[model samples]
Target: MVKDLHGKNIIITGASGGIGEKMARLCAERGANLALVARRTDKLAAMKEELEQRYSIDIYTFSLDVSNMEKVEEVFPLILERFKVIDVLVNNAGYGIFTYAHDADMKEVKSMFDVNVLGLIACTQQVLPKMLATKSGHIINIASQAGKIATPKSSTYSATKHAVLGYSNSLRMEVASQGVYITTVNPGPIETNFFDIADKEGTYVKNVQRYMLKPEYVARKVVDVMLTPTREVNLPRWMNLGSKVFAIAPRLFEWAGRGVFNKK
Candidate 1:
């Protein structure tokens, strides 16, 4: 089991807003030093200032786009130099692009993969050696319910998340003996800018807007699972059950999903 956050050095990507921002504050409350990373330097700086003022904990901010692996490699080491050690890495930088298979742009697909799959992989790779050397660390991957089930208009986005699900589990097993822990937090839907950013013309976006979950709710669940060290965590248990069952039996699930999606 992993230790509490007090005095631990933590790194959170996409820390400018949404669940990532909430996680940063929660970690501060637990007395962890944080390195907040995002593309928005102003936002990162503001959050860093607030956390330092309120919690009196060490806080560093970096304006980074995780999709750039080289930049991630360079910035991460600098963060480590500042903090001296990183005990946790939260791979929370991601976006959703909900579009039908044919309607999806290849460029958008690449962007999704770069951020959700490759970026996540690169960050974890950078941190793995340090964690393994010490034989202690925790990696929290923020995925989605779409990771397990392939919804109609969210094909590419779902694919990337699915990759996360498989990759996190495999990484967990590989590092289990070394005392490192990896957990995947799959939340169904969260009331965030996801709908605004997603392809609005897609069927998935239309459907998702109708059943939105709050980012704070999802963030809290993520924190709870991290503290407890669960292998796989899903919020709103019913959605988890329904999605998995749907994954196991696609035809029946598709029929049901269609019924629900088609309702006016």
Candidate 2:
């Protein structure tokens, strides 16, 4: 079982919308003080106001683009000053760009990685020292099922998520002795604006929308993990199992995925 999270200060990146926003609300409802980070100041401000009125908890919103390493360095200390000690770190800021490697724009791919991988790493590094000093904390990364299995037209996005899984897994072991926990939340298909963020044209967007899962389901599981000491949490267990199965048999998985796409 995990310890209680009541009164704990938590930091959630990309909290302006989608999964991040949902997670923020869920955490607040559970009595966690929050430092919400996202590039959208207006959205965060509105959320902060709503949560404060509804929950009567302290909420701080920072307009930050986690992909900017320099900005991250500058903003983290300010976050610490406001929260005093961050008990949980949620690296939930990311998006997808569905395109084959050969045809995908390198700049777009870089942006995805900057937010998905480097941003996660930079934020984690900044929070680690404090967590280590206190000998307690949770690092929950919002990874994707695509990270565990290859998918057509999402090669670059998949690669970066795979890196996240690998990085999180390794870091978990490295910090186990220190009483700090690292977990990767592999969500199959959260019904969020992720597809829209992909900025895909043509039939690709329509095809991707068919497998959407509600973001609340993902957010609920994140709360479950924070309240407990699970090393990893995979939403909609069947899909998680399928990701593992497909990883072992790429051709068959590709064939099935293609068929699914064709049907849509």
Candidate 3:
């Protein structure tokens, strides 16, 4: 068994609600201190109030838009000031949309990469130095199953997640000898506000609802991952297997799963 997370400093981005919030609560229960980052201050404050009630832990809130490199640079230092040693960093701030590549909104596409890819990288880079200094730290990246197997109507979103997966895979190996753990999460779908934004058309998320993973399930597993360092996590095991199959026999799988894969 891995050591308890008691007193470990963990920073979670996009932590105002959903999986991020649930993960914070789970980590708090494990006695971990948290730095919750999000663009919404009111939501962050509310979360802090309730989490403190149940767990005696230091909960710091930062209203941040991780996509803004300037803001990230400005605020990350304050985190270091309060929490001298960073133990874990969870890059959970990301979103996706269901739209064909040709019909995709460039604004949304750029924004996705900004937050999903660049933003995740910026946050990881911020704490990376400290982790290197200590030769001990964990970095958890929230990618997606789409990253593993690209599908129609989610081309741009899939590209962003694919970037995350590539980075995590390379980074994990780079820092392994230095004792830093990097874990990438590829979850199929979850019951969260993410669907509201991702599926504005009410298409994909609705159809995939039955196969969706729960926020709490992912949250609990994320916390468990922090305690027990691992390479990667793909939730709802069946979906993970499909990704593997797609990787092994792309043409056959795509031909057989055309409707679901091509649906708009």
Winning candidate number (lDDT): 3
Worst 10 residues of 1 by lDDT: 199-208
On a 0 to 1 TM-score scale, where does candidate 3 land against the true structure? 0.97
TM-score of 1: 0.93
Best by TM-score: 3
Per-residue alpha-carbon lDDT of model 1 for 169-203, expressed as tens digits?
99988998998889998887777766668745554
Model 2 TM-score (2 dp): 0.93
Indicate the residue-level lDDT of 140 in model 3. Answer: 94
Global lDDT scores for all candidate models: 0.83, 0.85, 0.91
Please provide, for model 2 over 172-220, each residue's C-alpha lDDT reduced to its tens digit, 9 standing for 90 to 100: 9999899888989988766667766564464654555566678887787
User: Per-residue lDDT for 1-264 in model 3, tens only?
Assistant: 556999999999999988999998888988999999999999999989988998889999998999999999988999999999999999999998888789988999999999999999999999999999998899999999999988888899999999999999999889879989999998888999998888888777668878888899999888888935698888879889999899999999999889888655
For each candidate in turn, the TM-score is 0.93, 0.93, 0.97
**Residue 196 CA error for candidate 2 (Å)?**
1.1
Model 1 Cα RMSD, 1 decimal: 2.2
Off-target runs (Cα >4 Å) in candidate 3 are none
Screening candidate 3 with a backbone cut-off below 3 angstroms (N, C-alpha, C), the clashing residue pairs are: none
> If the candidates were sorted by their lDDT against the true structure, best first, what order would they fall in?
3, 2, 1
